[model samples]
Target chain A: MADIILNPYYMQIASFILINIILGISIYITLSTGLLSLGSAGFMSIGAYTSALVTMKLGFPMPLGIVSGAMVAALAGILVGIPTLRLSGVYLAIATLGFGEVIRVWFNNLEITRGALGIPGIPQMGREITGSLREFGITPDMLGLRANQFSALILFFILLILVILTVWFFVRLQRSRIGRAYAAIKADEEAAEAMGINTTYYKVLAFAQGALVAGFAGALYAHTTSFINPGDFSYHRAVEILIFAVFGGSEVIWGPIFGAAFLTLMPEVLRGLADYRFMIYGVLLIVMMAFRPQGIIDYQVLDWLKKKVKRNKSASPLDKQKGGDA
Target chain B: MKKWMKVVGLIVSVMLLLSVVACGSQGTSGEGGEQSGETESGEKVAKIGVISYLTGDGAAYGEAITSGFEMARDELNEKHKGELKIELVIEDSAGKRDQALNAAQKLINSDNVLAILGPTLSSEMFVVGPEANAAGVPIMGTSNTAKGIPEIGDYVFRNSIPESLAIPAALKKAVDEFGIQKVAIIYGSDDDFTVSGYEVMKKAAEDLGLEILTTEEYATGDTDFSAQLTNIQAAEPDAILASSLYKEGGLIVDQARKMGLDVPFVGGNGFNSPQFINQAGEAANNLVVASPWFPERDDAQVKEFVAKFEEKYGKQPDQFAAQAYDALYIMAQAILDAGTVTDRDAVRDALANIKDFDGVTGDFSFDEIGDPVMEPVVLIVKDGKFVEFK
Candidate 1:
């Protein structure tokens, strides 16, 4: 067991986590706006292929390649989003699905995306035994630290900062007037439209933000995996991200975290289960939805937790009468 | 419940159950996708179907090999008159087992091919090979490298050596030639090809008394290898025996080099492609691989075949193409020998008794399990070309 834990495969599991965390955070951004535009996977494929092409063909510096990949993907997201913001719910899902499929087919046909041959030989980032800053002579011992501990530390913290930034923005959005506008859109768009909130603009912003995160994740994934194919970023993967958002409760800041953790570990935990693993996954999804329709902990539960102290033990008749009247 | 609603609900449940069953068995790409489309068959021609993963993850390999096979079919059709006309129908497996199996059924039942060329995944081969065999059709797996596949049925045939034969000798050759001691075995944990090859390598490595210093596993979709390379670097193995297909193999070698893990990397049959070279850049120049086909062989027959293939495709054919070329020749031989395509049983029996039929992959002969009994080619990637080594 110890040997397995220290195996390089474990490092790969961490790699999976790094990419998923980026995606989870990306999905988290859209969930915050109360608008699940559901099209980030398209952007992910765009970024992945872009980084793969640049890195493999142009030989750009790893960091530059990743950033450019993300930038290109975000641009694509903006382009796709401009035409898709008018649809709501099922219509939005269908359009986004079309976008995903279009990217898939385009990648399948484009000579540049290698048209399914897939781009290989991407330069890997982060070190296994040594941290990057150590190359500049700031060894862990020199900085009073253990060696090899922080060489790839920046990548993780980069992901952490992304998550933190997204959460902070989300919480801020939840409290702001515009955030309230998003909530109104989520709860009832018709009333929000009557109230003068520009639903289209907010929805477009939400889609753009979500797509941006997916692109960032995609770029990071390209650098980390050092290889990618059209198969990696498919419509099924978009659903995986949605599953992550929903599984994490979709209400609290840590919802994506919960979802990412579960999905990431679920496959590993079920490694012993072999072919039965996917069946179990489907079953788990059904069980979770049946028991916890709003997810394990959503906004309502958190609000309840906050107002738990010093409340009247029972509803007074006047309060009850007021509640009943309402 | 209302009658129609209850009927609809039952239909939905049955659909789900049927899909689950289909997926579990690894045949048919769901219901009515292609099976219904196979309505006509040419009785005069010997029709063969290639259920290949032509446009997805393994697309490069599939496309490359099929190019060679397709070329052979064109040339064969030109040569043969009314006796044994060979026709190949290209269908995309999309790397799905059910799809491949469904393709096999369609080819056999509707297209009524005397033989089928593929179902590339070992699991898919497991699913479809038996049925093809039972129906008296010989299945020539162009690139199913996983061992024990021929056991699916007696009528199944593949043009490549199984892992048992390939892995042990390949390792012995590496150990003898490279003088390697410790080895780092890296493979994809998800796919049966890599996993099966890894298991064989594990035993062969142990039996050879080589130390398994670091065994790293990565999922099929994982692209990052820094941490794993780091750990392998720390272990400082003399060689890295990677059981990966082209894309991952390219990334593994590239990353291992970037991390300064400068050991020579050895790959399985998956490395026998031009795409790997294109992907691995200069780093692929010195990579060693154990393959089943050598495009640059000096054999008289080989030279002629290579000349014909290159002339037709306008590019050098990879191992997959060579293997598929051999597989098609094998079918052609059986068909010509049997003297009729309508007697599927005779065709299957003729293929079963095949012996010493010199083809591109090598002397073709089928073991009792219907697998090609052949030797693995020793290859070293040199300056954007595959050079055959002793």
Candidate 2:
């Protein structure tokens, strides 16, 4: 099992799945606050170019580049979120959609980012981080890993940590005062503002948080793929990111993770279908939506499952047997 | 709840079915490899993976490339007879970078191919090239004409003429033939191919001591070129140099003609297609471009290949098909020369050492950096057909 999972083929797929899960959760953050911003792709591009350029030109280490990428994206998110957050629903979506195009065109024309030519040969996180560790007299062989396996293993762990951290952050945020403010704003923006809840502050905060997560995901994505052009982040990508949250059920943190993992793996699993691969994938998504309009793991399903488990534990022996039979 | 259960069951069943298919394919491939080995017929089989846009917007190019490979495969197997056999593993990238990367990874790791042929576009190359190079597999680009492709790694190779070579050759011919003193430039700025081609055209025009009047840019999917054509007309240059794909390149030429800006229009490799003439119609006349493949060339080999291709595909072969045919033949020759079907390192060396190999595209060889070193022929559109420019 370890060998199968650690092989280069599965490793590549695993990395992509993890990156997509991060993107899924990133959009989920904004969706939870009821803000339909189509700017995740823009924030992702920001993080990608920022880290790529800094690491390549300024000699920043991979970790630093990743952080700076997320930070810069958060800053842009704040700048974009402040003015655009006032517009609700589809209007905000359009504004953010335009923002995405503007960023794409900006990178296309910029000389430093190499326009549409893209920056290739960016250092992979696994090899670069492992090489630096070797300089400090630690070696991958000591951990029973080959050179290639060592790099892939390191990248896998880094992404795993980021995934865990994002999930934990959301879990905590959902229980806090800001989370309630977000819920309130999402439930009714005018009412929340009437109640003096500082709706704009919480909305902007949610947007920036979403941007930060997306930016970090993008930074890692660029390093793993080792190439990025302006075309990589387009309007289609923005919509795809939103689909992750929508498909997975935006109400819970696990929804986006499940959604991202399923969707990302579906294409690879369907590879044998050749020309019909994407067609089948689209059909599957349609089927999933048709079957579960509120998504597979929405609040009602969870509540029902919880009640059923409780009843199973407390019922009489005869009732328990009947329940089991049913 | 029942719907959810049904959906879950469906997902699980589909996954199981697909896994069985994947395993079944792998099993057959293994059996085939062993069967080839066991046969005392002295026949060798080489697996070469092909990644191209078999669907989506770039499907036209992909279809042409696929047909070219199929034709070359049929001819090579028959010609080589008992000595060699090439088994191609074709994967569609759908003209996307991630999909291209996934295709390359699958080809390199799952299929265990000795080499890879293409991912079509240069943008796809930028992503797939590094992956193939790192895996130590030789990948040759059939249609990636962007700059800095070969620079990705020693393992990367391209037979397609880069715009840097084609654009300069076309401009020089235009300068000598038309005696043009000045030129205006227009290109699609959103694409890597056209942008690089534009950069090459600008430098080439300046190098030939021609004055550039004005430059205009448009996005790739844009159909209206009147705004940019009007700007070019206002500049009043002797000729208009354009670096764009056939879609926009044709429209720009057509728009320029309608706007009464008639001078010889010199274009990069993008304008070397029959589709360009189809798009521009009568306006296509006097349009000049450089190409490595010319079906109308007075060569017996070229004529035979073109005739055979038309018979097979029931359509005229374009430059893309010609290049792809040449690329596969080049791969087969290298595999035969190395005398080892599975040893990739030996095959890579043989491919690099390919010298004076004649193909439908003309005599071809790889320079020090794995870029094609061949003279491109200058052709002008005349009466909706390409003819050798004097």
Candidate 3:
């Protein structure tokens, strides 16, 4: 198990899982607020292209590229959300889907994005982290590692930190007033509106937030993979992000994260199956849906776990008495 | 609830066990072959990674590549007579970039393959090439032909002739023989291969002093070319030049012919597949394409390769298969020249130093940038098949 965990191939898979988790969370934010937006991939493309151009063409630092990418995607989200948020349900999904297609086509024909040849050899973020570490008098050779290996380790920790911070932000949002407004909007929009809530404002806000997260993920993805293309943000990719959210149970913040991680790792684990892996993946999804329609990690499971923990805490004194008797 | 949970847990455990057993069986089978080869040779087995799109949109090309690699593998083993056994660890990318990356990583880190062949598409090569190069693993692209591919790194190489070399050959033929003064150009704007092919064709046409009367663009997988064809027909160019894969190129030919535009259609390497002729049927006639391989070539190596490939795969080998076959042989010859399979740098150096490798494809040699320096043939579709044009 230690060997498997330490394998560089597995480490790469873990990085992919982390990236997908970020993408899943990006979509989950909007889904939680009663909006089924299919624009995450578009936002991701915007972010990826923006950051890639910034770093590659403008010679900006990677950090600045990411911030600018996220900001641009947020601005695009607002522009798209203002009009589309008026529609509800499938209508809104179709609009966003169209928006995603538009972005894909626009990038496909654009001159700066290289017209489908894709921009390659973007600078690696690992080098930046290692450079900073070197300034602190911590050299990679001191730890008996190559520079790239040390870079990868630093990258993994950076992703870990990002994941924790994003999850914490989501948790805080879930307990806040805006989160309640979103829940109310999801539960009964008409009622929420009757109770003096501005449904459109909250919905657009949710969309912009999702776009910001997706853009941030995309910026990181461009730097990590060191390549960006229009095909990477097609409608199929949007559907994949949606699947991650839906399959994981979008009711909770962690559901999409779990879904993305499990799905990302599942194919790698089933590599032995060869050509049958995808077929088996489809079958497993069907079986999972049949058995647990809510998702692999639904709200009910969380509630059950919470109740079990409470029960265990309350039974500790009685368990001590029982231990004395034994 | 508890009963359901237990049932789910049991099923999950069974699946996990099955997968574990599957992996064990696979490993043992591979080791079994290696052991026999090693006992006879008294030398360590050389493992090579072959990544291709075995399923999905690009499966046809992938399957052909795999067949070519397998043929090369079997022939090399027989020739060496166990003196230098080669084992191929093939992985399917399913025509997706992420899958290609995963397969490349697994090949480099876990399987410890000496060299990697193919991620099939230019776009995929863009992603996996850098990763492999970074890891110091040599990769030979069997069919990647876009610009700047060989420039990825020193570790990257490709046997397939890029459009830059192939396009001018075919275009010059069309211009000289037919006195083609003006032509219509159509290409898939979304694809790297087609887009690059278009760029090459545009440059070649301009250099040849041939006027480009019209230019049309379509996305891949679009079956309808009436709008583009109609627009082209109005221009009344002497011939049509298309830069696309077999699927879309065939559609364009059929649609162009149906619209009564019977001019000769010139294409690039993407039309070298038999499927293009099969798809367009009678309309496939008069379609000229530049290719690095022609299976019907009256050469001893070509005849033997075609016979073996057809006998094994029960189909005529295309250019993709031909290039892949040569790629495997090139790698094998390089390893033999280097005289070491375990040292990746030695193998890479030997590959870079390879010259005058006569194979099914014309004489193969890598230039300084690791791009192949080989002659491309001009082929025209005649009576539902590709034949060498005089």
Candidate 4:
């Protein structure tokens, strides 16, 4: 178990899965509210560059860098969301898609970002912490960590905690007043406004929260990869985030998580396919969608399963009562 | 319920099918391992990983690179029979940074390759280089020519001459031949390679005391160049200096010629390809470019390599193939010189100390920074073919 946990390759993949889950859920938040904003990658880039610059150029700690990164992305979200959230469905997707391209070009033109050359050698997260731990005579090898695994393990734990926190927040938000407002707005914006739901405010709020979560994922990604460039966050990536939500079934929180993990791992598992892996991946997605258009874990399926279990429990008691009467 | 069960059954069956396919490949790989193990009992095996864009925009370059390396491996293995063997584990990066990073990790941690070659593009290199450096594995790039590549770490090395070196040579040749007093610059600003190449050309032109005309920038994949070309034509410089990939570079030249602003074009390394000539058609004539590999060179090694590559691949090897061929030789020679195939530090040291090594790419050596120090040959397009510039 220790060996498996400390395996660098698995740890790396797991860390990436966690990050993708965050991205998946981030887009899921907007999807649930009937908003098809394809700007998560833009938000991610803002978070990655901001956090990387904060830590590397400004000499701030990783925590401060992460906070500032998420804050900045959320701020941008509020700013962009307010104006663009008025557009809905495919139009909103196109507008947000343009927003992503603008951010990419903006980073490409900035001197501080070093234009297209990008910022390389950004200090990796957990390096300092590990070093300080070593100074305290608590060496990683004593705990069975191998070369480069120590930092990877540290990153894994941090990502795990963040994923848990995000999931918890998502669950809580679904039951809150904001969540009901989101549902109402998604069902019918006109009706939601008629009910005094302030549809715009709630929509923007969901967008901002999505941005904040995506920002957190980006900051972690920048540090995990230990590098950042504008090309890393493009329109394709935004679409990929959307795919995770859609393919996993956007109706439930578990959908995106399942979708992201399965998709991310599918590539690795498909590696054995050699040259045919990508083709196979595409075919599989097409097949899955054909069969389960609502996603692998559709809300209707979950609801049916819940009702069936309840019925089975009630039927057993009824059968016992019938037997007693006989 | 029946439909739900059917979907579940289908999902499970697809996963099972995939896993079965995966296992079959794994079994084959296992057999390959044993085959190598059975050879010479205790003989050393040098495991090397190649990360290239096997299926994407950069697939052509990746294909050329991997085929070059494969040819080198076969030839080297035959030459060193019973002494040392080489095993290559190739991974496709698909031209993405994260995929390259994953490839690097798999190479370093899982396969434990002694060295790595290529993630193809410079953009991919930026992400993969640091990871290899951190993990204490040497990585060499055959096609990454951007600045600061070698500066990633001591473990990072590249034999591909940067645009900083290649551009100046071409520019100087153009300046002397055309007697140009002023030059216009154009580049794709959104890409790392073109951006770096542009900076080099701009600085080289300034250093040559040429008057700077108008500088135009365009993003990659932009089809229309009328706007940038119009500005350059208005400047009416004696020559045009461009730093862009072949697609955009070719279009710009073709457009400028159509607009009657045809003086001459001195292009960076990106314009050295046959594709550029094909893309620009007759406008490609008199275009100047510099490269370390010249297929038409009369040198015996160059002639032999070109012949063998053509025989094997049924196509003439490009600059990328020649560079990759030499890169593999350099890496293999380093492993041999290190005398311990598994010792990465020793191989890196050996690689760093390589000097005056002759290959198809001309005399090559790594400076202290691990960037190659090699002379580039300046050539001009004449009658739709590259010829040595006078």
| Clash-forming residue pairs, model 3 | none
Off by over 4 Å in 1: A1-326, B1-44
Q: Write the per-residue lDDT of candidate 2 for residues B1-390, one digit (tens) a residue.
A: 576666766866875786688567656654464322213687888888999898788899999998899899999999988988888888888898878887887778767788999989998898889778766799999998988999999999999999899989988998899999989999989888888889999999989999999999999889888888888888899999998989989988888899999899999888988888888999998999999988989999999999999898899999889999999999999998999877888898999999998999999999999999999999998888899998
TM-score of 4: 0.94
Q: Which residue pairs in candidate 4 have backbone atoms (N, alpha carbon, C) closer than 3 angstroms, thus clashing?
A: none
Q: Which candidate model has the greater lDDT, 1 or 2?
A: 2
- Tens digits of per-residue lDDT, candidate 4, A1-326, equal 87657666677888899999999999989988899889999999999999999998889988899889999999999999999987988999999999989999899999999888788877776555677778999887898775477877887899899899999988998999988998888898899999999887889999999999888889988888877788888888998998898788898998999999999988777775677878888888898888888888877767877998989977898877988899
How much does each candidate deviate at the interface, measured as C-alpha RMSD after superposition?
Answer: 17.9, 2.4, 2.2, 1.6
Report chain A TM-scores, every model.
0.79, 0.91, 0.92, 0.92
Where in model 3 is the C-alpha error above 4 Å?
Answer: A1-6, A127-140, A307-326, B1-41
TM per candidate comes to: 0.51, 0.93, 0.94, 0.94
Show where candidate 4 strays beyond 4 Å: A126-128, A135-138, A300-326, B34-42
Q: A35-77, model 1: which lDDT tens digit per residue?
A: 5656778888877777767867887766677678788877777
Give fnat of each prediction, in order.
0.00, 0.45, 0.54, 0.57
The residue pairs found clashing in candidate 1 are A131-A151, A224-B224, A225-B223, A225-B224, B28-B98, B28-B102
Better of 1 and 3 by lDDT: 3
- Cα error, residue A291 of model 3, in Å, equals 1.8
